[model samples]
Target: MTAAITATKAFGATSTTDEVLEGVNLAGKRVLVTGVSAGLGVETARALAAHGAEVVGAARDLGKAKGATEKAFGKTNGLTLVELDLASFASVRAAADGLVADGRRFDLVICNAGVMATPSGKTADGFETQFGTNHLGHFTFVNRIASLMRPGARLVNLSSAGHQMSDVDLDDPNFERTPYDPWAAYGRSKTANILFAVEFDRRHRERGIRAAAVHPGGIQTELSHHLDDDARRRMTEVVEELARRPGARPFSYKSIPQGAATSVWAAVVGKADEVGGRYCEDCHVAETIDAEGFTFAGVRPYALDPEHAKALWAKSEAMVGERFP
Candidate 1:
């Protein structure tokens, strides 16, 4: 099926939060956004709350999240903060359970929290740090609360163009057998984000729920905190290469507001339903990347394969030791 919204709206690569959300009213709508301590997460929550949506901001530290929200959004009435640390399965379960007990039906859930290229480490459950926190953490959290989502709810997984870096290695997701590369691990986790959304939409759309993965474009966010000097230099070289490609969109950094635009659009845009299971960027369903030129901004074909998505979903369930619809 074609995308419900194939063309970009008034917003573009440079558009800000208020600009993208102009004319939208979300009064009484309940939403959840992860990683609200700073950067895109804070701007996302602030912008949505400004538009009248009741936003629940999840962070690893409740104090930081509350302070950040207040600093960014200024004591908004509809915004609340919750503690969530994606590295620990127990934390993920407890956070979901708390939300469930609150009894608030969420209309949208944005899995925006993730780690970047970090040193090799294992999570509380013994999974690779990047894969565990970025994909598995959100995976278990969403499944635990899937039933609590209101019908027609939107699930937005914050994927990345870095998904082009690698496909998920299901057999060794924790890098037990193969040597670990930080960027490769991060890429696999990002790819898992897309695959998760693809399979999630397949399973849940019939029940009035839909999921989509989003690439928020190049932005300076705390997600890059783990990037050392060498890593940053390599990333710069890649961006420079992309910038030199013929017909490639110019590589540029986005303000936090601009970076948060696509996620907000996916969450509340009217035509978002048409692109369920699709990867989105710049406020629209992104094109598939061509094998010859990786400069174009779009998803890689492997990230959207239904078979791969399904396989990854099963693998994820096994890792988490739980079954989910």
Candidate 2:
């Protein structure tokens, strides 16, 4: 998995979302990007809409999202403001069904919303909050809308480098028997994102649909909202320590636009057509983690296994009591 796939490649980590989209125009294309109130989510939606794509800003609060969209686009034409609380399966179904009822067949679906390091708690569906919201919610949302994905549609799941922390423990996904480590929970969900994309592509590639998982690199964003002040301080300290370590890759913190680059690239860039299932970062297909930056780069073998991906997809379907065509 550490080997890089160079079949098609373009921009790199420093590319901004706008840059990756420089000559492309998504005019008349319809796209849906979740968690669009701020950070990479807002930038992603803005970038797409700026290029004439009719974008949907799916957020937890329609009011905040309206204001955010207005501020980003100056006017929200081609931007449909909608509510989607990923912590609730009911909410995910309602949002998808609402889109379906409205006759929206999305050209692109970006599962960009996620939570990180949440304290012990359960989502409205009584699943672990981080795992449920970040993985199961998107899992249900994507499957429920699979039939609506037109031929050649693209689906991007926002996974993370944090995925390296753990794989999905199907036998104990809720941590009822094992100790619940927030980081581990987050890792499992992120891994699920990758697994989801792998299986989705396997199932639908023949229909011209493409699915990809993206790690947007380290960008300071609202994904950390669940962390308390003390936890935030500790997280910062740990990263700073990693930064100071000899031979470590420089801690390159991307601006929101930069963070949004890869997701948009995966969604609209022509280069991604042949690159499904593999993980990407910094707007390009990542390379192997060399000794110097061995800590970052490329997908772990476990995360990229097609069998593992299919297994997780089947398990997720069973968990949500739904099926993807």
Candidate 3:
């Protein structure tokens, strides 16, 4: 489950969504992708839908989503939209409920909507903004729709390499006792994304369902717009310093197509058992790195630890006031 597959060695960081999914036919599949109003989400939906799958995209702004998807779809069809604001529990519940009531099963669920580093704030439900929108929101929404996933369904959570910066603090996920560092808060939330996948895969894989987290690589999307000039400069300095280390891969911005490629790779191309409960990037299961600092190619060991994932599941359940068996 940890090693990269030779079968997927043909694809890597530079691969586009179409490149990775070339010759792959997804006919009759049903996929749900969130955050479709922009960036990777639109491309992910576009590629899947174009390849003959029905994709229901969720977005906070339905108006914007309609415009974006229409443009992305171009000559392609099979893409639909649902209203969802991960920042609001009401929206999450309503969306989940509507999908459940419809009685249709999904072959894949990609939790891709998230806010990056931003000024400290709280959700409508009073949880930390980054943690709430990025993790708790998807936690509640996905669990509610769990029954709709077909037995062989795969759940792909769009995590980030930033998870290397820190581990989730169960006792203080909202940064109550700890000082709020934007990148650390973002890291905690992203790591939660991975842990959520780990636990979900463990709980559901017996039923022919599995989950994996994905790091989409560094893409120049609006995802990082929250970073001010100084913040961006500081991040650049850190990456530059890291690049100078022995055997480090220098970071470079990826095209949106390349960014969305890994999510597509995990949801459709990866073998269920090989990728289940693992963290993937560049179309392969990433090696678990034991070193300090983030790298372009691997996941941190803590991100995949069973005990860490289990604790996150419990804490997430408590935070959202819901539990899944």
Considering lDDT, which of the candidate structures 1 and 3 is the better prediction for this target? 3
TM-score of 1: 0.95
Regions of candidate 3 where Cα sits further than 4 Å from its true position: 1-9
- All predictions: root-mean-square deviation over Cα? 2.8, 4.1, 2.8
- TM-scores of the candidates are 0.95, 0.92, 0.96
lDDT of 3 by residue, 25-79 (tens): 7888899999999999999999988777889999999998888988877843788
- The lDDT for every candidate, in the order shown, is 0.87, 0.82, 0.90
lDDT (10s digit) by residue, model 2, range 1-325: 0112334446887889878777776776888999988787889999989887888879998888888878887888888877899999888999989988888787899999998988989999889988899999998888887888888888999999878778899888899999988888988999899988988988888988888999998888888888877667856775787777788677878888888999988887745455676778877665534232225456677778888888888888888888777
Highest TM-score, which number? 3
Which of candidates 2 and 3 reaches a greater TM-score?
3
Where model 2 places Cα greater than 4 Å from the true spot, the runs are 1-10, 244-246, 288-294
Q: Which stretches of candidate 1 lie over 4 Å from their true place?
A: 1-8, 292-296
